[model samples]
Target: MVETKLLMIDDEESFLATMEKRLSFRDIVVNSSSSGPEGLKILDENPDMDVVLLDVKMPEMDGIEVLRRIKAAHPLVEVIMLT
Candidate 1:
């Protein structure tokens, strides 16, 4: 089976860390960011990411804007917004 590579972007540091750990246990490769710009940078560096789990309400940049940018830059990468 192929492992799922996921990028999780949220301003909550503890949530990111906890989810990363839990998801990693489920055979998912998890990368994380605390802000939109950082998430974008991660996407830039890791183009092969399968999915992005993004928070809807975030500081610096919101999920909708991030989703737009992600779609513009990497349309193939799937994204899910979390409230």
Candidate 2:
């Protein structure tokens, strides 16, 4: 009965909000960010995060770059890329 800790990174605010709501209902603890930098910051702050739902295309920093950074720093964290 352990709750999943998910970090969602997407440029679409609406999508993040909707996913957060739906996932919360399922007992997930969701932390959302609209940009790569912010998402990285969240990851730094929440070292216990289990998974990341990352959007492939975003401004400020692209998902690929974010993925690279995440893997470099938080290699144990799993990332699922979203189109």
Candidate 3:
């Protein structure tokens, strides 16, 4: 079975850390960011990422805009938006 490589983007630091740990334990490789720009940077640096877990509300950039950018850059990557 192939491992799932995920990028989680959220403004909540504690949430990112907690989710990373829990998901890692389940054999999911999670890379996290505290903002949309940071998440985009991670995606650029790590093109192999399979999925993106994005928070719906953020300070600088919202999830929808981020999703647009992600789809524009890496259309194959799947995204799940969280509120």
Candidate 4:
């Protein structure tokens, strides 16, 4: 089976940690960032990443704007927004 690479972006540290742990247990490769800008940077660094689990409400940069930027730059990557 092919491994799924996922990038999780959320401002909540606990949520990120818990989800990363759970996802990692399922054979998913998980990468995470606590801010939108950092998450975008991570995406830039990891172009082969498959999907992004993004938080809708975040400081410094909101999910909508991040989604716009993501689509503008890397249209092929899939993003799932969470509130």
TM-score of each: 0.95, 0.97, 0.95, 0.96
> Which candidate number has the best lDDT?
2
Error of 2 at 83 (Å): 0.8
For model 3, state the Cα shift of residue 70 in Å.
0.2
State which candidate, 1 or 2, has the greater lDDT: 2
Q: Give a tens-digit lDDT track for model 1, residues 1-83.
A: 89999999999999998998788778799999999999999999999999999998998899999999999999999999999
Ranking by TM-score: 2, 4, 1, 3
> Who wins the TM-score comparison?
2
Error of 3 at 4 (Å): 0.9
Candidate 2, 19-59: lDDT as tens digits? 98888889799999999999999999998999999999999
Would you give me the overall lDDT of model 4?
0.94
Evaluated at residue 50, the lDDT of candidate 4 is 95
TM-score for candidate 4, residues paired by index: 0.96
lDDT of each: 0.95, 0.96, 0.95, 0.94
Candidate 3 minimal-lDDT segment of 10 residues: 20-29
Question: Residue 82 CA error for candidate 3 (Å)?
Answer: 0.4
* Residue 50, model 2, lDDT: 95
